[model samples]
Target: MSSYVEGALVEGERIVHAGRISAWALWHLIGLGIILLPAFGIGLVFLIIAYVRYQSTELAVTTKRVIVKHGFIRRQTVEINLSKVESIQVDQGVLGRMLNFGTLIVAGTGTSHAPLAGIADPMAFRKAFIEAQDEGQEGI
Candidate 1:
């Protein structure tokens, strides 16, 4: 668990699911050979981006809410209460489906939509979230 998510947790809120972007989803390895070139600035930039994204982004679901955190210095975080969530949409291309990585778009009440890309086992994440939501609602 990242410090960001841990610090964001409220009293009695427990994490139900936690996940990170898969390295394979980045596909930066295909361009790794470009680094050998003298003018490899573009390739290096891609590698840096992929590395940063893979390392910094986190997705989690708690008993109270769903949480997503991304970025390094200027961080971006999204938290949506389970009760407010309207839908969790998953998109996977052929490759993504084969590799088990996809994008998850979470739509909450109003105009809020949080899109988490390259997430590993997005289906499982959605399942956990739905289960948590059911459990939370049952308690009410």
Candidate 2:
């Protein structure tokens, strides 16, 4: 099977985060469940946004680079090269730790945009990603 991978920059890195389409439900769970808006009309507008985010989140890492693609109708993509990466860190909350899901922070050597954001399985990914970055630099 083949998936349309967005143009990215990664090398020997496992997917740190790839959100499921079901993330839409999370918005409602928050906007509606927690906020408990009396009128569903205005708040519903933001709900649509949350739904879109639920659908848009797609963070991945491959053998070449880091890829971030989001947005529903209009899509936005960001790619970061491993060599430009200055450091990698894993962030986990109580829930994220138990679920094997957390955010991966990629610190760039130069610009912050060079880093990938909000990726899952940050701990495992950082190790492999750093190794790949080292290898790539060593090669050059």
Candidate 3:
């Protein structure tokens, strides 16, 4: 759990699920490693980029809202109330479907859609969000 995410939680808001960055995001690093096998130093840069991306990005579904954070130095955060969430659209290509990783597009009441790519177990994340949303609606 990242401090940025923990600090963003409101009163009584508990995390229902925490989505992870998919291993698929490291594909670029793998390819670079192979191509730059002789020059290991260059390959290391790509590996670091993948690691930073995987570690800095955070996704969580809470009792009150859904939260997403990206980047390390220049941060970007998105929060949508459960009541305002219209739907979660998932995009999984053949490779993604086989590897069980995909993109999750969270559409709010308006025209805004937050598309998170290279997420692990996106379906499970979506299910957890929907369940939380349903429970919140029932409690209202």
lDDT of candidates 1 onward, in order: 0.87, 0.58, 0.90
Q: What is candidate 3's local distance difference test score? A: 0.90
Which lDDT value does model 3 have at 13? 93
Candidate numbers sorted by TM-score from highest down: 3, 1, 2
The number of the candidate with the highest lDDT is 3
Q: Write the per-residue lDDT of candidate 3 for residues 35-140, one digit (tens) a residue.
A: 7766947877777777888889999999999999999899999999999999899999999999989999999998989999999999999999999999999998
Per TM-score, the best of the predicted structures is: 3
Segments of candidate 2 deviating more than 4 angstroms: 1-51, 113-118
Q: Which residue pairs overlap in candidate 3's backbone?
A: none
Error of model 3, residue 68, in angstroms: 0.4
Per-residue lDDT for 1-140 in model 2, tens only? 33335334335445543433334225444566446445656666666676667657676555456666767778877667766667767667786676555666677667584333444556656676766666667878
The ten-residue window of minimal lDDT in model 1 covers 29-38
Better of 1 and 3 by lDDT: 3
Q: How many steric overlaps are in each model, in order?
A: 0, 10, 0
Q: How much is 72 displaced in model 2, in angstroms?
A: 1.3
16-117 per-residue lDDT for model 1 (tens digits): 999888887877653662663357466666677777877888888999999999998889989999999999999999999999999999999999999888
User: Model 2: what TM-score?
Assistant: 0.59
